[model samples]
Target: MEIQENAALLLIDVQKGFEDEEFWGRRDNPAAEENITALLDRWQETGRPVVYIRHDSVVAGSPLRPGQPGNDFKELVEERRGKGTGPELLVTKTVNSGFYGEPDLDTWLRGAGIGQLVLAGIQTNMCNETTARMGGNLGYDVVYALDAMHTFDLTGPFGWTATAEELTRATAVSLHGGQFARVVTTAEVLAGASAS
Candidate 1:
């Protein structure tokens, strides 16, 4: 999990919205935010670029509506914003992938010459995973900071149930070994970041 100089941390939807337990239901990885914070600290200390993707949900009554309190960045990210340290860019998206909508992350990444992305944040099987897959298809070296991402339980229309753990495992299985990204634990990611 050695990170290259062009590697940047891409945090997706680490917003206050996800904190609403009733809205998101039961989630996994209670320490995901802690891990994301650690990564942010390391990236800031080392002066590596960090980017944040916010999900500004267009769905009315969604927790991520732009004017809602839940739409605000998580306190951890907020405290670091515009400090010129942790996140050098913040891209907002209306969909599952950060590469879409206005201020597209793909264009920004290319403009910044970023070829490697270390992904961390919420909804492992949703926005985070979508962005990772897109990054891989676009030929960027992608790494999944596994322990730094989390998701909630889901029930399909047919009553099929998937726990957060199961979803996370599926994402790892789908993305590993050059398919999309190599998944690494947050601890491993921290160590690698330090080493780099």
Candidate 2:
């Protein structure tokens, strides 16, 4: 598959709050941040457009609450934002899908003429997955950078616990091959970026 020259990189909810294992439970993909940084760096270097999605949870006791320290972006991502090497858009959301965020992700992408999106960030099975599905439905080419996202273990209503790794794998399996997004590794995305 070919990546568009103007494909936007959407970094969803790579916040400090996600570091709280006590709140989110055991997580997988320890190198997620590093992989996300790699993709961000490449985008910045190429002067590609980037959208930063922040989740400001309204749920009481949520670490991602607006006034909480955990609501801020991770240090590495924040530092990259400081460099100002590319076009940066901020989308703040209370929900899982970045498409439903403040400033209107779809409108902004349309106005900017970006038809393809490369996703990388936190909660592999939640925000990232939801955004990819929405993006696909909206007729945008979506790329899911699987290795660049992580998720915490989740307990189902039926009382079974699914490990983070399992969820991540399942999400990839469900989304790839024209289902919703093209699920691939960070290295593959970077290679596509370079080639595009």
Candidate 3:
């Protein structure tokens, strides 16, 4: 698919909180950050809008809670997080879906006349999945940058546990086709950025 002028890269919750392997517990897609960096670089070069979605956990003592060091954006994106005059938008949310919390990302995008979004970030089965679903439900063209997002193993009811790989695959399966978004690798997104 071709890139649209109104499309912006929506990076959700790539924060230091998720960097704690002890807490996250065996995440899949180890290269996710690299892929996301690649996309960010290309987007910057190609002049596509960039949005950074940060999560501020309402639960006290959570790594992502406000005033915590882990709540900050990961160091991998430090240089690209933007300073004065940079063409980047910083959006903060308190929930899984970036669109649903304070500073309503959906509303901001709509006001900016953005109608298409490319998603990348942490927890593929949670925040990323929720955002992609909302993006489609809200009538926006959404693309899932598959390799640029990841998730940790999750425990189900009883002793069942789903590996991160399984969750990632499930997310891809659920979002692909006409459901929520078209799942594409980071390469495709980078190519689209270059071609644009």
Please name the candidate that would achieve the greatest TM-score relative to the true structure.
2
Assess candidate 1 and give its lDDT: 0.88
Q: List the residue pairs that clash in candidate 1.
A: none
lDDT of candidate 2 over 112-137, digit per residue (tens) = 89999999998999999999999999
Q: How far is candidate 3 from the true structure (C-alpha RMSD, Å)?
A: 1.8
Q: Candidate 2, TM-score vs. the true structure?
A: 0.96
Candidate numbers, best TM-score first, in rank order: 2, 1, 3
Predictions in order: lDDT: 0.88, 0.91, 0.85
Total clashing residue pairs per candidate?
0, 0, 0
TM-score for all predictions?
Answer: 0.95, 0.96, 0.93
Model 3 agreement with the true structure over 1-196: per-residue lDDT tens digits: 6767557899999999988888778999889999999888777776778888899999876889889999999987777766322257788888888887666777788888888899999889999999999899999989999999999999999999999999999889989954799999998877766643
Q: What is every candidate's alpha-carbon RMSD to the true fold?
A: 1.5, 1.3, 1.8
Q: Point out where model 2 deviates above 4 Å.
A: none
lDDT of 1 by residue, 1-196 (tens): 5887657899899999998999889999988999999988888887788888899999988999999999999999999876644448878889999889567778888898889999999899999999999999999989899999899999988879999999999999999954899898888877777734
lDDT (Cα, 0-100) at 156 in candidate 1: 84
Off by over 4 Å in 3: 83-86
Candidate 1 wrong stretches, greater than 4 Å: 84-87
Residue 174: error of model 1 in Å?
0.9
